[model samples]
Target: MKNIRNFCIIAHIDHGKSTLADRLLEFTKTVQVTGGQMLDNMDLEKERGITIKSHAIQMEHEYKGEKYVLNLIDTPGHVDFSYEVSRSIAACEGALLIVDATQGVQAQTISNLYMAIDHDLEIIPIVNKCDMDSAMPEEVEDEIIDLLGCERSEIIRASGKTGLGVEEILSAVIERVPHPVGDEEAPLQALIFDSVYNTFRGVIAYFKIVNGVLRSGDEVKFFNTGKEYEADEIGVLKMDLSPRKELRTGDVGYIISGIKTSKEVKVGDTITHIDRPCSKAISGFEEVKPMVFAGVYPIDASDFEDLRSSLEKLQLNDASLTFQPESSLALGFGFRCGFLGLLHMEIIQERLDREFDMDVITTVPNVSYRIYDKQGGMTEVHNPGGMPEPTLIERIEEPFISASIITDTSFIGPIMTLCLGKRGELEKQNYISGNRVEIQFKMPLGEIVIDFYDKLKSISKGYASFDYHQDSYRPSKLVKLDILLNGESVDALSTLTHVDNAYDMGRRMCEKLKELIPRQQFDIAIQAAIGAKIIARETIKAVRKDVTAKCYGGDISRKRKLLEKQKKGKKRMKQIGNVEVPQKAFLAVLKLD
Candidate 1:
């Protein structure tokens, strides 16, 4: 145990975390780099150049003639997966804080650093990507020292892309990171940090042995779920599965029982000996809670079962994913799915299409609104269609977030203008090393969920990094903006917006729908309304036909008679013809600018 070191890397996206992981794996000879590059196994992650899931691997190395065991946990760098980072940190004893030398310290850099500190883990700062021509390693080192209060010599300079200083990083881990401390003779207690589903093994839980020994024949039970299963197998990760007869304390590995589904084994669950159960479950284990909610439906009603199966398969891989059955009069059967953030929602949608080969329509994303009625009752409404009637809603409350953006000083003015446009209130600003700045704001989640990130990137010219967390729910003047086609409300196109922007949002949506919705035989009047009052309207002009074009030199009265008859027929058809709204039309509205 004295020679074992457990650690994880923390960084913002594009800071070379995965590249560093690959270099470490190759340096230790734990796994071949397949050309000295890719460490991410998932095709999507490779294509996008980002890590969506946290991965753990056991590596063996020899430093100073002393054999060492290194457990490296590679976590997602995006802010959307910060919760996964937190869980990974809880299972380790130290963190490798990686900063992009060119970008200096970013918003997610500070956010992840705070999380590491909250866990009280030892941090080793590393300045990565030193090979870039734009690298500013000294400024970054100063930022790290300022934030961490560590000595200047404590910082390590490295480059994951060129494999520079890779040996030094490994040596630092062995020399600095403390070995895992636990009692191997104690009763079995383990943490289910993550899990995956397989047809052959059912549920395979990835765990770190906190105390006691778990063997192949041992019967184990989960403390939270209170279900027991025999340990069919145990093994550690070395880029691939390598079965072991037993897993001792301070070891990290995978366990397979008779279980076959994700529902049986949950992440953050505690596993212990069934007969010799520990006094109580491990502390700091909590189920993932969702922050964003949206309705998802199949384009075809018959695909409902297929969609259900696909969601179940996805839930097997993602413990934070939540869903339940829902029905809509307009969209038919669907599910109300909850996600940790907008990125998670998008990734799930893409996976459904790419992995499951299913075409699904997602409704407008919205945050849960707290509805307080005159009867002194409170209710949480996730969907606009599920909101109470306007008459009964005394006050509506929306979720807010405390967001931080780190960027160069030159772009601060434009970024602040964009944030204020989204109803953000500036709280504070701090100057970091050189011309970099960190600006904080309080803003509604509804605004941020739509296009805040995109706008921020555009205004900053891609120089800024952002991170946010749910702050609180506060009362707001809110209203539901409903879209009506031909004077009929379309439930799928309804959205909740702040009352102040209702007029302009209604106008923009009405005009956008007018452009998207195809013109029918009859004139279609697209109107945006709040309750029973219409705020904006647009007309798709009726298809016109030359009723008198065929009239050559005939009497003018004859042409008039024909035109009169055609007009009467058109009025009759307009009364009977029903406009067919397409699913793409609804999608266009949700994706409106």
Candidate 2:
């Protein structure tokens, strides 16, 4: 245990966490590096140039003729994947806080740092991207010192691309980070940090042994589910799973028990021997709080059960995802899914399509609200359709977030303008260093759920980094805006909005739907309404045929007769015509800029 070092890498997005990880792997000769971002194995991750999952691998390094075992977990840097970072942090004793030389310390950097500090993990500050011409190593080093209160000599200046200071980082890990401490004689207690599903191998759970030893074929039980199974195989994580006879205390490894159901193995649950179980489960695991809610329905209604199974398997891989059965009048039966953010929601949708071959329609995303009635009965509503009638409601409270944005001084004005437009209140601003500012704001989570991140990125030319956490809920003047098609309300199209911008937003949504909804044989009336009042309306004209053209050169009365006949046909069609809303129309509500 003294020679074992378990640590993870945490940083802001695109700040060289994966690149530095690759350098570390190469330096330790863990794997043959043929390309960059070797740990980001997902194709979507490669396409987006972002890490979506936390990857763990074991490596061996020889220092001064003494062999050492290093367990390195590379975590995603995006704010949406902060839960992944938290899980990785929990399983490690230390973290490498990587900061980009050009970008300095951004919002996510500060947030992730705070999480590490909260976990009491030893932080080793490292400045990456030192080879770039625009790199500001000195300024970034000073910023790191201010953020972490670490000495200049302790901070390592390195370039992930050039492989500089890789050896020093390894040496620091061996010298600075404390070895994992636990008792091998105690009852077996392993904390399962992550797991994955397999068709041939059943479920594979990756865990860190906190106490005692886990051997192959041992009878193990999950603490949360209280389900027991024999360990089919036990191994340590390398580029691949390397079989081990036994994993003792302070060892991170994987165990397969031929567990067919995903529910049997829960992330953050404790694993213990059936004969001599641990007295208590491991604590300090925080539950995931979803920031956005949307309905995910199958494109074909009959595929509902398949969608449910697909989501179940997907949830096993992404424990942060939460869902329950829900039905929509407009979209039929589906699940109301909770996601960390818009990007996380999009990625899940894409994954469902690519991985499970499940074609799904995702409704407009919204945040959950607390609805209080006149009788003082309170209900939590995640979907607009689930909201009670206006007459029965007394007040509605929406979730708010404390958002922190780090950007250049030049872009502060536009960033503030954007936030203020979203009904955000400026809390305070501080100068992180010369010309770099950190702006704080208190904004409704609903305001930033859709396009705020994209807008911030575009306005700042990708120079700004943003991070946020949920704050207390506040009572607000909110109204439910319903979209109607020919006097019929579509439950899926309804949304809760602040009264101040409801009218304008309703108008924009009606116009946007007018462009997205395909033209029917009869006119389609798209109206945005608040209760009995129609606040905005747009008409999608019918696809009319030239009925009068057949009577060309006819008398005016004859043309009028033919037009009158067509008009009667259209009126009949309108009465029975069901508007088939294209899938794009449902998604268009998100882009109402």
Model 1 alpha-carbon miss at residue 111, Å: 1.0
lDDT of 1 by residue, 1-593 (tens): 78888899999888989999899998888877886335577778887888988899999999989998899999998767777888898899899999999987776777788888887888999999999999999888888887899998888899988889889888888888888888988888898888877767677889998999999889899988899998888999887889999888888999888685556777788899988998777777656767677899998999999999788878867767899888876789999998877778888988899989999888877778899998989999888898888998889999999988989899999999999999999999999766789899999999877667767877876668787778999999999999888777877778899999899989988888777778887788889999999999999998988988888996789998998998898888878877767657766665678
When summed lDDT is taken over every stretch of 10 residues in candidate 2, the lowest stretch is 546-555
Off by over 4 Å in 1: 35-37, 400-412, 425-442, 457-473, 518-523, 541-591
lDDT of 2 by residue, 253-293 (tens): 99998988887878899999999999999998999988788
Alpha carbon lDDT at 88, candidate 1: 91
- TM-score, per-candidate, Cα-based: 0.90, 0.93
Compute the lDDT of residue 467 as modeled in candidate 2.
Answer: 77
Which ranges in model 2 have alpha carbons more than 4 Å from their true place? 400-420, 424-443, 455-473, 552-554
lDDT of 2 at 394: 94
